[model samples]
Target chain A: MMSELDDDLVARAQHGDAAALEQLLGAVRVVAVRYCRARLGRTVGAFTTADDLAQEICLAVFHGLARVRGPLITYMYGIASHKVTDALRTAGRTAVLHSLDELEGRADISPGPEDAAVAAELSAQLARLLATLPPQHREIIVLRIMVGLPAEQVGAALNLSAANVRLIQHRALAQLRPVANEILSEVNP
Target chain B: MTAHHDQHTEPAEVQHDEHLAHKLATGQPGLPQDPLSILLAACRDDIRAAENPAMPLLANAAHVAVRGHRRRTLLAIAAATLVSGGAAAVVLARDAQPGSPLWPITELVYTEHADLALIRMALGDARAAITQGRYTDAQIHLDEAARLLTRITPGTPAQQLAAEIGTLRQELAAHLAAPAQQSEPASQTPGARAATPASAGGTTGAPTDPGSPGQRPATPTPGGQPPVPPGRDRPQPGEQQRTTTRGSSRPPR
Candidate 1:
């Protein structure tokens, strides 16, 4: 797993190696971006919003690096989890505030003419499906599949045992399967 | 406790379902492409697509964050050094060498600039080995150089060293590509030919290192990147599920 290499980087960074610190932050950026995008999906300004959140997560890790004692990946993801929740909470508030302004912001969230393609529609559909899952399940699934974390690392990030991660993953996908199939049927029909 | 309760509630089904879930999540080859599987794959693709465009901006942000931290760290270290004074610092600096036990202290003090010459020497060895078609030797030197490069500050000098390493890597690739293509078809047949005898020899040579063979397949992946899908195959719990699914009697697609 990447965490094996990351452990080495963390060791180096802790010793005050600036290059290693930078490299460690780079890896954190990748994970943060993947997690944010995966969690946020194609909501209005999803790309920019995810990038901004990822930047915040990176800065958070940089400022907090000295305090981190555990696996850096787990620490970084914990920060990412918090940042994403904050963003989602803010987005929720904004959505309610703009509920009256239907025309302008609607285009941003909705699939435009360019997004009429199959892949975009499929991603949008899947994003909605993912949103319906419980938070822990959704987070586990995203970290496992989207962030491509191994079950052990996913367990570490989520504070579950590896066995628990696998079990939760199974149950979560089992829940998604019927809904996903129904959506496919509707699209085809 | 919750995990215990869940296990108690679904003792028999949990393991089997976990195995199946792992199979579907991993998109194991020859899977039936069920809708959930497709959606999972789509979800992965979505992040990957976003990753490329956003990488540069994210990298810049990381750079800015690190640079700011590095400055603050430098100021702190300078202040510490001023307080600690020069005599003991000189003694430690003089003591820290490649083989010395105090070598780690050099790392702690951020004195990795000392490794620059060693990196250059390693790079020279790598380049000569590359020229002589000693690819393995070149790889060894390159690995050493890269390891040393990590110690130094990542700026212009390090970037130049990396560029040189890249050039050597390209040269190494070019040398291997032709021979590799020629050997590919030939190796397969001979590999098949040797398979039985190799297995027989392996059994006879059981005293030979078992861990080496297991680790050999894992060495090619470079050190820094996140776990790719194939790399995800290495986790112990996932391995069993993978083997079981692959060996299952499900109809071939």
Candidate 2:
């Protein structure tokens, strides 16, 4: 029901209805912030906070709405993902390390026992393996897996062809396989 | 042990591959734990906050609308001014003497062309100066270039070229105006001046090579040596000097 209302509101916004523009943004704000926060959590305490970066993404989307020509939810997600990726690229190493330091300092945001063990182990292994892959391949994998974007939408946001997205996905998985197997064996044994 | 090993190897490979594909599809882990769920939920909240109807989006729309209206109004006024100015010029031209230049304004226009070309050449020289770290010379060339461009008549070919030259001039000016960075001394060549109108018109005794020595450099060279004067004699090895007296017979204006 909310989805239907969101679509209608977006349509009105597209046609220059400011009231509807506000309503559509209201519906999508949570999704936008969370997407940014999860991926950028490690850098939360940097010069540009995850929330600040998220706001930048929102401002970029608001101004860039005319470039979109699809369903509002889909377009919004695409814009959000692109902005987050751009922000990460622009933030550089100092910002990233600062964010990671913040994450380390935070005591209240710990993962659950089961997932914590898995995530900690996986994140450590993945970090090492990720250094081996090209930036483009790493980005596609992060967008598709961590960010939970559909391959088609990921391709659209990244300005990649769908076929290219699938190829990158295949290669990224193939690269991760050996590492994943090693980690699994160590864990299960 | 052999049977158990075989069972584990094949199924494990299949499961791992499938899990990867599933991860790609859902953009999340197959094992959904509480922390991951919390993070995903938070992301959803962030998206909602970003999209909040009462915030920055409305302000952005208003700003764009105002800018668009102002641009349209400016464009309309400029178009009307050009049309009216051209009509008045045509009416005034019809009342003038028969032998007068088709457009007396055209001579001014031609002069403008030469000036624009000179400005463009000067700007190129300024860019070279900036690259060589001669900030003072670059500033002087940039100012002259701007003044030359400003003198151009608005509807001529030179005017169009002036617009392009103006942008480059501004950039050069800004760099020159900035505080001097570390200065590296550059080797200077004698300046090259534009061809004089007399030589360009094929007048007798006009310098064949306007860039030759004996002609004064219009701008000071980097090493303080004046540029070679145009049309001074320095004959190439294989070229013959043929004096074919053509347009030189015309009476001087």
What's the lDDT for candidate 2?
Answer: 0.45
* Model 2 TM-score (B-chain only): 0.25
Q: What is the lDDT of residue B116 in candidate 2?
A: 48
User: Across residues A138-177, which tens digit of lDDT does each residue of candidate 2 receive?
Assistant: 6666555555555555566567765556666666666765
Interface RMSD of each: 8.4, 18.0
Clashes of each: 0, 33
Q: What DockQ results for candidate 2?
A: 0.06
Worst 10 residues of 2 chain B by lDDT: B241-250
TM-score of chain B of each: 0.33, 0.25
Supply the global lDDT for candidate 1. Answer: 0.57
The superposed Cα distance between candidate 2 and the true structure at residue B182, in angstroms, equals 89
Which residue pairs come into collision in candidate 1? none
Indicate the worst ten consecutive residues by lDDT in candidate 2 chain A.
A41-50
Task: Determine the backbone clash count of candidate 2.
Answer: 33
